[model samples]
Target: MAEDSSWMTAGAGECAPSAELHPEIAHPARIYNALIGGKDNFAADRLVAEQLSAAVPETVAGAKANRAFLGRAVRAAAALGVRQFLDIGTGIPTAGNTHEVAQAVDPSARVAYVDNDPIVLAHARALMSGSGHGATSVTRADLRDPEALLAAPGVRDLLDFTEPVALMLVAILHFISDDEDPYGIVKQLVGALPVGSLLVLSHGSGDLVTPEQAERAERSYDPAAAGIHLRTRDDVARFFDGLTLLDPGLVIAPHWRPDTPPDAAADRLGIYTGLARL
Candidate 1:
């Protein structure tokens, strides 16, 4: 993979917001980190996270489950011979990262991790040190503009559009409301890839949660801020309309090719995940 300045030098003058100062008051990324019991979050993040957790303990389980699904989906696609991966909305890096999963399956695998959160970028870059020197990189970009994320030098420098690639949209599309055209955004990304490319995704769904529970979770976030727009299973499945789903089609997080079913299948955790090939 070729080195690019988009992450270090080029992004300095670019228009993008970061989580450097830790806007704990209403920071979703930090709150999510707190829910996962990570130390990188602030007091405000913890407060919101605790409240949200009290509203739904299944959230914590679902977060970890979604991450596990990401690893499983990545490894599965790698087994299919896809070497390059473009991970969009990669939240604050947890234990198993994109490059780690892909590279574990194949040493030469190249991955580009993109996210708008400054904290995610900071931690992800630090984690990549000494390991994926050239194979893995972190860039600042929003999911709303898949084109910008795809065009980011860190992405283009390593990934070749002519080859099959995996477009990872794990646990982030729920933040994007219907008005933002989340479906259109995904379609644009898939349209850019080659024939054998894959679309890896996980979305928040009201399918598993009761009406009151789903409403409570949605209201937990500040309406002005990014809200979790929980969709029905059918609506969630529509995001992958043109593509062919992998073995476990649009199932709940744990149901989609789980290593071991965690004995909590009936209690829906408001998340649905699936992988599809183009």
Candidate 2:
């Protein structure tokens, strides 16, 4: 899809200062956007995406699979009667966003999108503005600081803690390194949700690649704000501890309750995805 310049025009004033965006450095979200054939990215982000795609031919396909998993997971949550959603590490607005999918299931469903990236926040705010979706709100917050993220006025105001919520961490955790205590971060956030809440998560895996290929993929993010940390199936499964994993638990992205038969290219994708109930 072409880059929608309309978001920039609508949210020009809301965008962060040039210094904050750091267009010279590649960000995971922006690179992912580029990999998915999006135009809202800088030269640096595109370069990284190109390098990764060259090394791993399945890079772009993997990104699309991850996005597809997110859509299916959200629809499943909505079908299960989840009316509230807290989506942290939300990347730049794209099609089939959390609010779009959830609200499509039930117009009254509320969605709170949290991301530390100013560009993402600006675009999200602009999209929500144009959609006239009063139940949705966007907040600028980091996943590393769950306390502040959960307490942000935008998040607190729009979501009721007493009710069930769909906590979406899709395609975001891989950006967090081991020192950052990714597991602890997830546990803290999941702890805050009421019983019956769901956790929708997807993370990149190195299991399908050779050591050399994995190294090359990691190097592609050298210029970015954060380095990639691909995990094993066991490591990724730990994130869902204490929750009830749904059918086809903790499988590769394309295999998780696939809406349609996955093609040959789908097997080469390296993302692991699953949904669990609290």
Candidate 3:
């Protein structure tokens, strides 16, 4: 596959449900792109992502680390012989997408990516098309609207709800506020799946950073994007209430069965990651 992507269509933007969605706002996905040094972001998103990066200079690394964890987690899910995947808050596409990783482990893997961003929907759909790609789809919808996401036409077409599916929520929880009932949202989403399903999730953390730094980062992301509610370790762990946490439990990112040995890569393991089986 020729990997360099152009916009799924030049008219994709104008053709979206509405043309009023301001491209000027600093959305989470675009901010993330800025942190990763990608060109898919707007100037506003770069400003905030940079501000947060200044507070925790590792914000860039933090974002990249979360992405790395997503890949490792997806591969782990496929290794369990679980071939269906439901990836929510699917950020702007880059290296190692859930379908790509899952399909790499099992060519027959099926995936459905959900996101509220039109840009993400457009790009992901482009890559997921054509044959020999397993079965993959993209849904433009909110995480809070789990029902809508689950009901999306493409989701129905690709994933069988009756089977064990890996539910991926990497680096997206923090963007969802408690007021939005993120916990309830997760519970309902997981509740919809059958037994042996998995919830492979990750969240940004404020544990190692000073309170002031965390607050500054939060303030930096406020004007646009979901306001950051960088949770404590226990808080992050709360998202996995009903499921059994896999070995190593909920821990720092670099600590989760890291590709690198324990002592050598200890310093960068600040992001919290976990793979739970339901």
Candidate 2 vs. true structure, TM-score: 0.92
Encode model 2's per-residue lDDT on 164-236: one tens digit a residue.
9999999899888898899999999999999999999999988898878888998889734779999988999
Question: Scored by Cα lDDT, where does model 1 land?
Answer: 0.79
Error of 1 at 112 (Å): 0.8
lDDT of 3 at 91: 85
TM per candidate comes to: 0.90, 0.92, 0.89
Clashing pairs for predicted structure model 1, backbone only: 19-118
Q: What tens digits encode model 1's per-residue C-alpha lDDT throughout 142-246? A: 788877777877778768899999999888888989899989988998999999999999988877767887787787877676677889989899999999998
Q: Which predicted model would earn the best TM-score?
A: 2
Q: What C-alpha lDDT does candidate 2 achieve relative to the native structure?
A: 0.84
Q: Is candidate 1 or candidate 3 better by TM-score?
A: 1
> Which 10 consecutive residues of model 2 have the lowest summed lDDT?
1-10
Task: Give candidate 3 misplaced runs (Cα > 4 Å).
Answer: 1-21, 129-131, 223-225, 262-269
6, model 2: CA deviation in Å?
Answer: 20
